[model samples]
Target chain A: MRHSLTLRIGPATFRIGSAWAQPIDQLARLYADYPDVDGAIADFTVRLQPTSAVRRWVRPSIFITGDHGLADAAPMSLAHGLLAAEMGMNLQMALGWRRHLLLHASSVEKDGRVLVMTGESGSGKSTLAAQLGERGWRLMGDEFALLDLDSGAILPFPRLVSLKNKAIDVIAGEVPAARMGPLLGATAKGDIRHMVPRADAVARMGEGGMPALLLFPRFGSGPAERPVGQGEVFMRLTQASTNYVALGEPGFAALTRFVAQVPARAIDFPSGEAAIAMVDRLWSEIA
Target chain B: MSAALLVMALRDPATTAALDATGWNSLIAMARAERLIGTLAFRLEGLGVPDAVRPILADTRDDAAREARQAIWEADRARAALAPIGLPVILLKGTAYAAAGLPAGRGRFIGDLDILVPRDRIDAAADALVAAGWEWVKEDPYDDAYYRQWMHELPPMIHAERDRMIDVHHTVLPLTARPTPDAAAMMADAVLITDGLYMLCAEDRVCHAAAHLLADGDLQGGLRNLWDIHCLCEESSERQDDFYLCLFEKAAHHQLTAAVWRALRLSHHLFDTEVKAYHVPIEVDYKLRWSDRAFISRLLARNGWGQETRKALVFAFFVRSHWLRMPPLMLARHLLTKWRKGHRPQ
Candidate 1:
């Protein structure tokens, strides 16, 4: 690696190395508010390497790799280097992290309790989490939600909330310009911009909140809510977790305990405002 | 170069206690690259590690345990699938290690299940497996024809429901390879492991691993393959008297004397495996042979970052693999076909 940077994201620190300086520079700008953990050993390392020697000069492809790698990962052009770095970090956590049962969900903390939203890729969880972050809810995380195995608390991951397509202008309207990263246009996922959580979220990232609500949010639907069954929740969560099968017995035990304790629902919304109002009602109704 | 620390950690786990954060990080990366993290997890069990590194190993141990179970379950599925055919099924390599409860199976990560059948029985066994829900993984006609014509195993098959792969072989090495091990003799000596499962005899098992490591492939991921030989030899030699004697005799009968000897010398060199047998010495030579040193460098080509450092030597060994598999004329034709088909080095 010719360039490198180390920064702490909530409880985990990442040491990102790259064959080029542009990606690291972009990451530094996006995560400027995050604490610098220079000289600290990182839990994961992400490398943005060139696909080959020729590729470094011609077409300049980036192969994202680290402690763990997916063999079928296609190389990205130099334009998407930052996205590649983020994916590399996510890949390492998905494959290697074991201190927590990781859930592919977004979460926000309020009054010492947490609300977790999970669904498929286009589920609008990121938009809701980002929107609520400004409306008095401290955004916990927008990507992976780290669940403590023993305590069942949701530890904050606090990565930048990546907004895509229409969600960009929606959240960009609320946050100040300095709080948002540059618009990355025409990515594989189409037009992504990263929004940093408020300063309080970064400052209190170490705090863990008890999981009080679990909702499966679906976007582009009529406003409706229904209770999700225990069996369905268990199966869906196992699928949502990248390391559930790898954790084996402890994973089974932790998930079983979690499903028993937490009440879950599937909520449908036509817009973010409607979703937020329903979420507020749901939160107050629970205990 | 980073392989030094990795080899030390594998050969003697106690020395790893002195490793610092940097040392442990590099060691773990190298082990993962070698696909021996599970083996290292087992080796470092009960040993103290840094605060942060503990969960990594613990998680790896759990993952390896899951892999072992899945491997055995796949083997069981094959057993039940092929029972009606009435042909013997012999487990090979990692699957055999796990089924026979060998030391090599401890924390072994098996990717696919390998089994052997008689040459005449292979077609029936393959058909039976397909009937049992195993589908051909290779869609390329050339690859399929290549496997059926020149390879030891049929084109790899993955179970439709389980998503695991199983390889059916009539013998250990490819038919085009120099040595022609008597597949029937090996099948005859297959000891019954369970109701419908069998593995090669003790001597044949070790020899087959040696031949596979040396003759069958480029010593890519050679560390784990060598570790298998080390654990197998260490266990069998301690428990069974005359184990080395039988190993050597089988090696000669299978025409794998050179491959087996090279395996022993390399394993003893890299891992200090104890091979106390007549006429088989691991004494360091003041003058090392060219081939001997090439094999050593080829095995240690990977750096701590899991990157292959020695490109020239790596390519040489890759060609050396195809060279060992077939004669020059056939090798040229095969290489051309593969190259023209847009097969680039991964």
Candidate 2:
């Protein structure tokens, strides 16, 4: 608890405490534009500390702990401490948070309507959402899509878009250098760098948008579009949601309403350009 | 003062109305950490909160309510599974409180289902539970053997599809423990709440809570258990004479008179649990006098955050828990084996 930072993202707030100042300093600089929590209390907490007293100086590894933590997760090196802190915050929200139906998805909004994309790793949802933000869409969130359980709206959580491996270079080419955090190399998930969201995204983090479309995107596949049914979407979203079971009936009702209202498609594209084109075509038809 | 605020709020709702957003947040966080959010939420009903803090409390209450509902379903499912096999499942602790509609169960969170059958019927019941799709929680040979041999219960079993666990206890304490409580007598005194479900009678329930708090657990997480005793005592205030007498008889019968006496004294000191005059026997009074002083400091110091300031006291109590359970020789061997296994390479 040496150095700490508080970040208010959309509806939830996180207090991240660190034993070392390096990770805190990096987060403060990267998240400078995000708003502070309205109240003194943060919804979730993340602690990044040395695994032991001696480990503080000797090849320190960041041990993540919070209200809700995995029992036997291994520690991350101090070099990846920032990522550890971020993951810790996400884990707390996914497991402990109850106000919203949390979906492990990325979202971008246009004209008060949001499009959500979810899939497994290497699905290109994060990369596509980042690319779309550069063009005209307002990046709503990358790591989690906060679905209002009662209102059926997508609350904005535009934290820094975490770009890993080739996606870091791809986003770097489009976004200016000043907006990028230090490139974190040799992370567990490959080289990861964070891109500060567009100024508008940070400014409008409190805004909520109605869901217009849901996309299950697959990368490295020949271009094809298939409509997803309500039942399939329900099952897939349940799998994607972290606290759906904990939230029980309320979570089920909210997700059921969302699937009934939103049009879903599984789009497979070989490259980013084709993915964008396919999204555009689907948007036109849906609109 | 922070440590007392949550309990005070639950005892009196007006205390919460004066609290600022920060106070409410800390209280909520502490309640969540202790798994007492539903209890707080239920107690706060009709007592207004600030608009900013209302949503947070509402969300917490919803989650807690969902959990409580699920607990009821689990108990029903457990009955369905075990009833046909003729093992009498006497619901214990949280599930028992909730199922029997006791005051202590309102807005409480039930983790795993605990049921007691006759000691001789333990194996037959375990087989029935397995036949009903509950499998041993631990596949490790040593851990499985440890529970089966030294422990009172089998290794906890989880239903294959539901993932809910059932701790099948034939008795309250481990078999190797110094005090071997007469499980048959306790079962005989059980009151029939319904045809299949039974609960420990009022005095027996109070005694069991005391024993579980002071004798069974390490006392690190006994705050909730102490609260259970407090609520049970308050609920049966009309029968205080019978309750106290029966509590004493059960404690003496189990040879846990000291443990039960300490539980009552602490509950009275901490939560102002009411008891008749001179309830503490003169013999146990000397032991409890210094214990009361030591525990007062440690218990009062614990805030919304966990109790970490009194590490020595916690450790002492932990060692005492083991010492009470097993003789010195067996305890040393058990501790050694545990330490070696823990240090062994994975």
Candidate 3:
């Protein structure tokens, strides 16, 4: 690792070392507002390494590696180094983070209450979370909603909002040009651009709120809503979580608490505006 | 010389509680690299760690518990599946350790369920397993033929509903391997756990672990393999005064004297496992060989950063593993065949 940067992302601190300076430079710029992490022992380490020594200079590709890694993970071109760094950090958290009941969901905080949204790829959850951040909701996170095992509080991660394809334009419209990252063309998940959350999201990252609403949002359809059953919610959440199984009995207990306590709904929307409206309506109805 | 941080921790787990952040970091990384995080987790249980290290340790510990439970459940399912085969179903390796409540099984990660049947009964046993919903994971004809003809086990199979895997082995080593242990005699001496389930006796268990470590594989999970030998020897030696005498006798019978001897010395060197914990001189019994130092260096090839050092040594051992398994001609053919099949033997 010739170049390195360390930053605290909410509950976890990551030390990212890289073969090239580009990824570090991009990450330093994007995560400029993160907490001071000088000489901090990182919770996890991420390294952007070349697949081989000669390969480093040949094609100049990057293998996103860390404390935990997938042996057969494919490499990415240096052009998507920022995306690689993000993936590396996310990979570490997904595989290793255990203090929280981590869910593969986006969340937003309003009035010290949290609304978590989860869906499959292209379900507009990222777009919705990014949209809600500008339209009065404090974006808790756009990738993972960290639920404290003991407290049930939805801890704010709010790293970078990964806006793919059409969602890039949707988020780019609301945020200033400075907040938007460079466009990554033709990735595995199609076109992607990372957007920094609003300053408030970074400033109040330490603050966490009790989860009030859980929504399974689906894009493509015009606005429709259904109350999701608890059993269905539990099963879906288990599938959604990266470390639910790793957390074992405590994870089971925490998830059960979440399913029992939080009000859940499956939402459908054609666009970001409709999803936001549906979220607001559901939040109001929950109380 | 001081052992690697992970080895030191395994030797005395309480010592880690006093380590600074740097020490904990190195220890954790090494443990993870060696796939011994779960074992460390159990050892570090009840000891208070730094707040930062708590979650990491706890996480792996929980996961290890889940793994053990799932492994045991898989073993039970395997037992039920092979019940009607009308042959002895003896558990092997990790499943065996856990089934018999050995220290090696505590916090150990068991992957696929392994069972042994007599070489003659293997076909019937394999057929019964496939009938019992163990679907063929390796559907390729070459792999199937390779396993049936050259290897000791059937092509690896996965349970259709449970998604778990079971590798049914007639013996530990390939047919072409130089050392052909009497699998039938070993099976006859197997200790029964339940009505249908069985595990290897202490001496045979040590021999198998050593064979698997020094003779069978590329030392991929060598640290874990070494740990198994250490614990097995320590526990067995304590239970019986003439444990080493019996062990050596069995090792020679299995044609694994060199492997077992190197295994014992390496375990003693790394883990401080006492062959004379009961006050008998065991080191004096077997003279140290110069080649033992090469393996000692090879075994401790991991640096403080958990990175695997000694690439040449690694490659040499890999070649030796294959060399031990088959003659040069067959080895060349196998490697070429694997290369052509897109599973490059590396």
Candidate 4:
């Protein structure tokens, strides 16, 4: 490894090392606002190295290895090294993290209460979260909604909001140019870009809030809203949680408390504007 | 390294209170890498951990406890599957430790279900397992043939519904290996811990663990294996007088005198495993003194030491493991085949 960097995001921290300096340099630049970790003990580690010696110089490909790497995962080309590093960090959190129950959802805070949104990959959760962050809502997290296993509170992660495919251009049109990293093309998921979270989100990453509402959002559909039953919520959240099975009993208790205490709805919207309006209507009704 | 410190603390609870946050972090990471976090959590349950790291430690413990419970359940499932075969199934390694309620199994992670049947009964056992919905994990013809022809265990079988693995072994080591221990003798000495469950006797248990660590396999996770030897030795302190005598006698019978002696020396040196007076006279000078230094460094190094320094040492140990397993002609042929295929058995 030639270069390394460590960043603390909410309760979790990451130590990432790379064979090439370019990825680290870009990461340092993008994550300049986040706090440095306390010490050498990071929650997870990510290593990005060339596939082989000859490949180091000749059309180099970056292979990822770390404490939580999958045994047969394929390597990404050096051009997508940053994406590979990001995926590696996420992989560790998804597989190894145990202190908190992680939801593969986007979250935002309003009036001291957190609203969580989760969906399948192509759903407009990231795009919606990015838009809401610009519109007075404090972005709590993008990839994971960290739920404290003890308190059942949603801790803020607020990492770079990954905007993919059309979402990149959609968010780009709204956000000022400086907040976005360079556009990455042809990723495993398609063209992707990372939007630096709002400064407020980074500044207040330590704050955690009680869960108020859960929304299962579906994009490019006729605008509709339906109530989600408690049983359905529990089953869906178990599917959404990366550490649910590993956390075992504690995870079950926390998730059960969440499903019972919080209200949930399934929302379908044809566009981001319609989604935002529906969310606002829903929030006002709760208020 | 903090890993070594964690092992130390596991032996003594008072040492944990003094560990700083950085130390705790490193210790936790090392424990996770070595698959011993649950073991540490169990050992430290009553001890006072620092406020900052206590929650994480508890979480790790909970996770490991779940895994241990699952392992027990899977063992029960395997027992049911083999019950129809009506043969004495000898549980080996981690499964045996857990089943026999040994200290070494307290927080250990059991990977696969390993059982030993008589050499003549292996085919029947395999047939019973397959009939019970256990399918061969490896689809490759070459790998399947290789295991059936040369290896000690059947091609690992995975229960289609349960998704757990069962490795049915006729003996502890490959048949072609240099040390041809009397399997019949070992099985005859197995103690029946519960209905239909058996474990190797204490002396044979220690010898088999040593042979597995030093002679039969590469030392990728040798530190954890050494810890097992340490616990097993400490457990036998009550019978210290006969422990070493039986250990040596078993070692000699198995042609594993050198392997057992090296294992004991390393365990004693690295972990302060108690060696009784009777065991003190065992030959330690037969192995190169320089090799001792290399093994100590390579085994304890936290990171993968590259090909030049510690990596070379690991490679040498790997080659030696193969050398001990096969005759020269067979070893050469096996190495060439493995090298050409770029595949090493997991």
Candidate 5:
């Protein structure tokens, strides 16, 4: 029942498991048009069976099976689609963590250092990261950035900067030849997303870069881009960070040390253009 | 002494039966060990509590007591490192039990340290902990978003290297409740010990505990509230009247009088504590509206209600009390706004 699907994230090729053998072949054929995908990992296997536990909040239209179990059981509803996507993303995060320190951040490379941009999802993190990546900066990751805890270095696990709605047009307009992945039907947030792969991500697979700066970016409807003060940055970053309290003494020490070594900034941009320009300036300074 | 005797006398056959069935001896033994460690904590430093309670410390035979003690020591070491940061490390609940000269393992079993810091300093606190080698327990994007957007506390952070866990609460209430008495005010009212950590005043602690019990509505939290009320009232006997009045004043100040009174009444009835003297000035009909008489009758029947009636009464009172707390006009306005915004009526 186990089947594999190769996903090219950054330069690394991860083979994903499908619970059934047939759909695995289907997915392989689906992506057969792309030649760059290297190899995949058989990490997950899904199944479809009649059980009270799997009963419909909604009945699915497409019943695709994978080596892991079921691929997209509930294909019709936006809620189910989001659930499936989240489940897949979670699987990737779990697998990725074993190989590297998976940070809850969005990242772009400046000079040799990775400028990690972290915020809650919908803080326009992926959009900003994608914009930076488009400006020739190496994209480390648009969702989670893998960091080496011991060395505080970021390892690239770049894939597509998953853009939704207007972001798709923005990215497409910016990079006309960018390949579009499958357009997921719909999501709770909006229509759906498929992203253009970051070229740098494909080139620098498994490569780790030192984490240079941490920035918390917010897009406001103002007229200018401003660098928020250090104290303000510290407060915002702290509020935004996960595991701040759990890290206890050592966690706090690591954060202070990390922040001291790297410049932490809160960038407020009025528009996407302003955001891209500000990041470009930061990239130049760091380089 | 009389209050303790009274608590001892009311111990019903059913109470004893339940306790015995649940291995109360071992639980008490664990509690006693924690109390012993609590005594040790005070002896090492007069962090809080009077010296008189120090002599009456009990003993325990439970192995979990040892594990709990080791955890306490580890936390103490971690607290020591954090003390120099000038932020008050207010040890909460189980840690407070140990620091306040009670048996460390006495009250309830605790898995890890629960500490409170000013919400503003939470980040700084995290940074300090990370430098000491603690790793985050789990990292998820949605979890980060949920904590940042909807929660008052960051996700529960566990030490990567040790068994210790720290729950950093920025606000005592959930974001949904929108409880008043902002973090700054609470921090301003905190009592700083010589060890450099602070403790919420008894008033705030009681209110916080009450809010938590009401929001969670579990048996254990109810039991804990009963224990806290009994302990705080008994231990602070000299200030008992003052404390009760202050508790009422503080609850009213925070617009939580209804929740506090409801929780107090329920805890009193459940534990057979004497609380009839405390009075609410509002008339029952005016307060509860539709079910005023029935609710009042049920409150009176607290002495002999069957388990089902007790449960129903608790739920009824909880709903009624919270409803009473809300301004009827505002509730109507909110409903109107929801309707205007195209929210379908359930």
Candidate 6:
């Protein structure tokens, strides 16, 4: 038995797979009118095989059918969860390709790019993104920002901000009436994700914003936060990008163009609340 | 002829296993072998060989052997071309392997050509190569910025018309570590081959190899380098005094005596290569640790497992030779670059 799942984030579509036979009707009922749900794209395909001396149970073969191409891999019990998470991450990467080109940092738009927060995964990017979104900042992407290579313009891919354990509680408390979803299973990091609804998804789905300010945000336990220099911000953000080297001359030109245009900064906040307030304040100042 | 050669090559279970593991279809293997043969023929000509005997030397019915020869030829041509640009090219692993008289096309396949140039002329050297129709290989924006801003070498370049690749480097490492040795001075003393191209003298070459081995840590690649050092030292032993004196001069010039001492000790222990008398004290343990058998053995097991290990080991010998010919600071700088890139520090 095999099962396939599809998720659409921005313009990208991801197809996933499962090993055992699953009732399509039940799956449809579960995902019916789900906000994150785009549409089903893959037909489930399974291949049976024999066990070999090097292995115990014969791993079933599963295939995902979609626009990218059919991806076939071993269909074990663990494959479903892994595929789902992979699809989510891949969607994020595709949606935010532009930002990925420039800084390779996570970002969210607010008041037409008046505020853009950038940081690596553990640096509280998701928490900050969620808080800003709650305060009326349009969610851009948690993973990658797809930048038009020629123009260096950022295209928006507003999606759910994945919140982990403590952050999930914090968001729920902050927006008590916010629609909360079930706890998704643990990921590689052992933290569970609860898909919270994006506040501006309905209004801003067709809207895109220009990037103005770049920020590198970090959460600290102690008090006393100060602004880092432009040089240091450039150095740190440049190092964080994925294709910084792969883009070659065009990449460099784009980076220089970006840095020159956007004012970069580093912000340190002791708590998520303080961080949200600071971001709001910064947004107000710039707007 | 092709079928017979394939049959003969497949007689070895190792080749069969490699073919299976890599999922190389027969057509792909044949095409790869043909390309390899073509590249080899091109490279041998660059080495000043007449075009007549090149086909004879490069001809291989066996896909793997032909492919290996082709890689060797590309590497040689890449090194040879560096001469026309006024830069001294120290042909590292591939050309060195071929030069050491290994089976013509049966050695390690080179992915890219590694050549060292003086630090001062790095920009000019890169421009020179670029003028010769070598395009800078595209890298991601972050990597592009990092290489331009921090790295010792520009992104690698590939010839537009040929299958040759070259990594043009200035200093061996990044600037953060403050490694010594004036690249400009070394280039001044470089030995000119045909055209305006030059190569580091035997002494500088040996020092470079030593530095590479020490700073690169226990990378599996070091095995090939060690073998190269052993073979090159043996070949140049008759001029041992001259080589040592040149090495001494470089060590003194660059203030890299510690690096030289460490390289010398490791060469002596691992490859049994002798170092001339120099009154510089060095920690033998630290030097030995670079080429320690336990470390090499582990790396070998991890990278060159199965029957292919023998051929890989043979390639490792020649690869080791390139490390000794570099200055210590250059090697340190190279290691730092790799570290900053999030690659395992060699």
Q: What is the lDDT of every predicted structure here?
A: 0.87, 0.80, 0.85, 0.81, 0.52, 0.50
How many pairs collide in each candidate, listed in order? 0, 0, 0, 0, 56, 62
Expressed as tens digits, the lDDT of each residue in B194-306 for candidate 3 is 76789999999999999999988888879899999999999998999998888887888988888888888888888888875323443333334788777766777774345
TM-score of chain A, predicted model 1, versus the true chain A, to 2 decimals: 0.98
The worst-scoring run of ten residues by lDDT in candidate 2 chain A lies at A36-45
Model 2 chain B poorest 10 in a row by lDDT = B300-309
Chain B alone, TM-score of each model? Answer: 0.96, 0.89, 0.93, 0.89, 0.62, 0.56
For model 2, fnat equals: 0.41
- Which lDDT tens digits does candidate 1 get at residues B239-340? 998787788789889999888888888888889988764634432222335787888888887775667778898888888889999999999898899999
Better of 4 and 5 by DockQ: 4
Candidate 1 docking band:
acceptable
Whole-model alpha-carbon lDDT for candidate 2: 0.80
TM-score of chain A of each: 0.98, 0.97, 0.98, 0.97, 0.70, 0.70
DockQ (Cα-based) for each candidate: 0.49, 0.49, 0.47, 0.41, 0.01, 0.01
Model 6's i-RMS, to one decimal, reads: 19.2
For model 5, residues A1-287, the per-residue Cα lDDT tens digits are 13445555543333443333443453454334444544322222222221221433234322322222233244433223323433453444443223344456788886777888887766678888887777767777787776444576777766545676667677777765535555554564564454554545656666778877777777665434455566665565556544444334444555555566777666777778988777767766753
What is model 3's native contact fraction?
0.25
- Candidate closer to the true structure by DockQ (higher is better), 2 or 5: 2
- Give the TM-score of candidate 6 (chain A): 0.70
What tens digits encode model 4's per-residue C-alpha lDDT throughout B1-346?
Answer: 4245656766676777787755676676666676666678778887777665666667676665676677667767767877877876788888888878888887786789888889898888888888878998998787798898988889999989878888998888888877877778999999987877889988888888887887788777677788888888889866576687778888899988877778887877767777765535553332336667766776665642111125566677878778877889988887788778797643
Tens-place lDDT digits, model 5, residues B6-77:
123222322323332113222222223222222222222323322222222221122234445655675665
Which digits, one per residue and each the tens of the lDDT, describe model 6 over residues A156-217? Answer: 55544557767878887766543554455555444545444464553455455677767778
Which of the numbered candidates is closest to the native, going by highest TM-score?
Answer: 1
Candidate 6 is scored at a TM of: 0.42
